[model samples]
Target: MENKTIILTGGGTAGHVSLNQAIIPELEKLGFRVEYIGSKEGIENELIRESHPEITYHAISSGKLRRYFSMKNFTDPFRVGAGLTQALNIIRKVKPAAIFSKGGFVSVPVAMAGRLAGVPVIIHESDVTPGLANKLAIPFADHIFTVFKETMGHVPKEKSTCTGSVIRSELLDGSAASGKELCHFDNNHKVLMVMGGSQGSALINEAVRENLDRLTKQFNIIHLCGKGNIDERLEGHEQYCQFEYVTHELPHLLHLTDLVVSRAGSNSIFEFLALKKPMLLIPLSKQKSRGDQILNANLFKSQGFAHVLEEEQLDAHSFLAAIEQLAAEEEQLIHAMTEAEPPKTAYEMAKLVAAHAK
Candidate 1:
């Protein structure tokens, strides 16, 4: 029990890092020293270093794991090899009891290093189907945790388990008034929050902006427009608030929101489900991704937790119509969310890790 240190790794996107962020404080409370290994420039470094200053953060070289052909494909292996060496060196110094990975490209090397270092590597997969990194890291993982039960079929059955969703406790503690004050938004109109994931979707941003005048008439807006995606023209617009991204402020924003229009990332949708927000989902198309968002969105739609709008059919008019439809179904969606399974708290999930740790 003396070596209660644990190493957490993930990055590239917010989805890959959320579960790790959620469990960090609980891990600390359980007396584990949490050290993180992430890519030098990935969002994970900014998030963990800024939000959890007590945790030691390590930067390692990592390459993107792309499905399509890219010139980087030829050079990424050398970068990955360097990352493995870095991760193993870190593992040797920390001698963590367990290494938990959320399955991003950076995690592949970390998981491999953990196996070589004889550390128990536990991975959490948030999509219906595994991501490319998780698929590659599965062999190195001692156990894989999934948010979707269907994912069990994609990984080694004996080594994987469905733990359902894990939500951060602070996300549920937000005050609506505090959120309203933060945005300077009056309660005259209901608030609608639009998120296009951590990277922001240009398609979603354009549609929302083109229709902003129409939408602002009915609702106040909080737009998480993604990094470098904010339009300078919209800076002083009344009833519209835009941010490149948010970290700790997200919970308050969610508390202030009455409706949501967002990408169908599992972590985000599950957070909406926990908050009982009526949502209109715009999933990333198969052309853009592995179509994991399409599956995540459709599942929520079937459960009555969301209204799905495919990219092909989305336009200025359809975007407004979907918002109207979501508003009309608000009560029903809330009821459905009420009946759904609640998410695990950070402490409970941390305990799960401790139970399985080497």
Candidate 2:
């Protein structure tokens, strides 16, 4: 059999690239050569380059999909046009059998280019509602895979299927003992992990710091503080360990965690659910996002998988109280999560993409 090639395009944020990360190995195992197209300096480029160096990475112009007015918005359409041309050239050159898009601004052009090149395109939507870029790319996509069942109603039902989230397999094999050793946590205390998405959250960082002294008394804390968000003032606290960000060690850190405090990014929250970790979610407010995080938090809360604390309501007292509440209700959350269906779609998705390959 001839070696087939596929192109994966997603970027701008970690959420857009995570599904690709989860599916790449499966695709490789099935004998597909994978290539990635993203912006020159987007988080996707950094993540793919660092984690999967074997993937051929292509950089294209990136345009921001803004909902609000900005001067850059005027110039960005041209950027998108340029990106489409670049993607078209790359698609023509590589002659990929199929294109898999994870849905970001960078994906719009690639999806369009793939359609024009007569390559089958598969898009995965991670949010309850389609994001702007995905919304635009839908017409060009041959198949749309959704994480939420409700999302199918919003799209052309004929083209969309509910696949659940693609969770990284390594996350399931984490060693609790290794995690405990890494954080220096004793069995006497429960371990709490705070994550603020990939870039870190200033709001969450401040809240955690203000409540650290009180929190440390009950739980050992492992905080993934995001790049450049670490506090030098809290450097020597034995009960609290801080990392600017974690990649290879994330699974171990998660394994040791007794509870999680995090943003309601779809990928991260779904991972927490997969791990059956009881969580307190502080979603980004409408001002910061398109309200997807709020919807994600609400869905998890309604399903009894998590507790939601709006960022507007977060303070040191409220934060501590929420943690306490999550602790009290941890058993219920874990039970609900355990009863829920696991996301077993990585292999299924890989097969679906390969089936479409020319």
Candidate 3:
């Protein structure tokens, strides 16, 4: 007999996609057919649809749930309502055994609909501070998963499990080395892997661009410029590689790299930590509603695994200094990261979700 089918939702950013990337293969190994419900606007829609053409996919409308006062807030509930109806229709048609939510605004509607249908729903929150989507779905979820232990108190403890963040195999194996070589790095040079989440950070791009000559002189550079901005940032860089995205080659870059300078999104941070790479975390504190990035950076930094620099305080000089310090002390940073592991989480999470779906 075929294993029960499950519907997975959540992904507006690489962080959310990172979770799915970690567990999708495991679910397949356990004989579960996983389907996805995500927004067409998110990176997931195109990436998942193209990469896993065989899997079932349902595109749905979604809106962000703003924490600050905004006109968008007034319309989010209506969108959620509509998404719920779309999700219910998907549930009825697919009759999935369960729904797994990675907890973003994109997953809210599907989770709500799953609850109303008496279908068991599971959610995973990546940051120490739960996002608005996860918070809204908390009361309805049958099982909740988290990356950080500090997040336990924020959710219903009985339903919550601390399964460290789900990291893809490429990161686990340190395969990002080739990405560095391809980027024209010399063997003796230190490499700083710069990424600004999935959408790409204009601030980060500008900072890196401003300090490129200095950065290139000291360390090898591989920049994942967000979509459509690579050309703008790469105007005259003949020595370094610039990419809009690098899904397949990230592990190689992660391996061959000496340090990482990335946005403090849970997805990127966990992947870096799993790779045991030292990082200079630049949190997007300017974003009023989503303070999760700031909180994540602080938690990891307090533990001495990485350095946190708030976006406002970050400048070319400060960034360059931080990179120099981290590059010099990479060994200590690597050791600190290795000691922070809570557990082997993805397999356990898969087992739990599989049991429920069955």
Candidate 4:
């Protein structure tokens, strides 16, 4: 117990950092000192620094992990190599009990470095299929934890376990009164929240905005529209509220939301299920991603937790229709969520992860 230090690594997007964020306090309270390694300018830096100032944040050199042919591909490996050296130095100095990675490009070097430094490395994959970064980091991982059982086929079964989704503890503590005070919508109308993942979807945003006049007549709207995408003209509308992105306010906003229209990212949908929110999911098209969201949305639909609207067919009419359908199926969705396996708390997940520490 002399060395309680553990390093958390991930970044590039909010998705990559959320699991790490959820586990930090739990890890800290369990008597571990936390340090984070992320890119100099990645979202993880801002998220960790702003929200958990007590933890030390280490910035290392990393290049974009690309799936397509880019000129930078030639130079990125050098950056990755540099990143590995930096990570190894950090790992040796800290002598952490473990290294937990919520995989992103930033995590690849850390995982590799952890292996070279003889530290146990654990990875958490929330998608049904591992993303490129996770795929690369898997070979270096001592153990892999996944949110979906289906992900087992994609990972080394001997080292992986399906732990189900871990819902952030703060999400369950939301106050309806605080939520109501934050968004001044009429009590008579049910609130519908529209979130297009962390990066926001233009297609989803367009569909919502175009049908706003009609949609608002039935339900009050809360929109997390993504940064720099807000239309100034929509600012003063009484029945609608928009934000580029939310950090601490998310739980309250979700508490006020009776139903949700969202992208089918595993993390977001599972949070909705945990909250028992009936949702209409618009998954990003295959052209836009590796189609992980499509698989996630389809599974949720089969489980009765959501209504799926593929982006290829997304339009204002279909969007509103999906919302209407979600409302009609609200009770059924809640029932499904209630019957499903309950999610793990951040503390439980943190401990399970710590079990793999060196």
Residue 232 of model 1: what lDDT? 94
Q: Which 10 successive residues of model 4 have the least lDDT summed? A: 179-188
Tens-digit per-residue lDDT, 1-358, candidate 3:
6438889998777677667756777888887888999987888888787767778889888888765789988887787778889989998888888999987788988998898888899988888878887888888899988888899989889888887766665466655446655676545677778988777888788888788888878777888888888865464465567788887777777787778999888878877787788999988885643678888899988888898777887777888888888888889888888787644556666887787773
Over the stretch 25-100, how does candidate 4's per-residue lDDT look in tens digits?
9998898899999999899999999989999999999998876899999999999999999999999999999999
Q: Pick out the ten consecutive residues of candidate 3 with the lowest summed lDDT.
A: 168-177
Pairs of residues at least 3 apart in sequence or in different chains that clash in candidate 1: none
**For residues 10-73, could you state the per-residue lDDT of candidate 1 as single tens digits?**
9998888888988998999988889999999998998888888888999999999888999999
The lDDT of each candidate is 0.92, 0.91, 0.80, 0.91
lDDT of 4: 0.91
**Structural similarity to truth (TM-score) of each candidate:** 0.97, 0.98, 0.93, 0.98
Q: Model 4, which residues run further than 4 Å from truth?
A: none
**Cα distance off (Å), candidate 3, residue 167:** 1.8
Off by over 4 Å in 3: 1-3, 174-177, 232-238, 286-289, 342-345
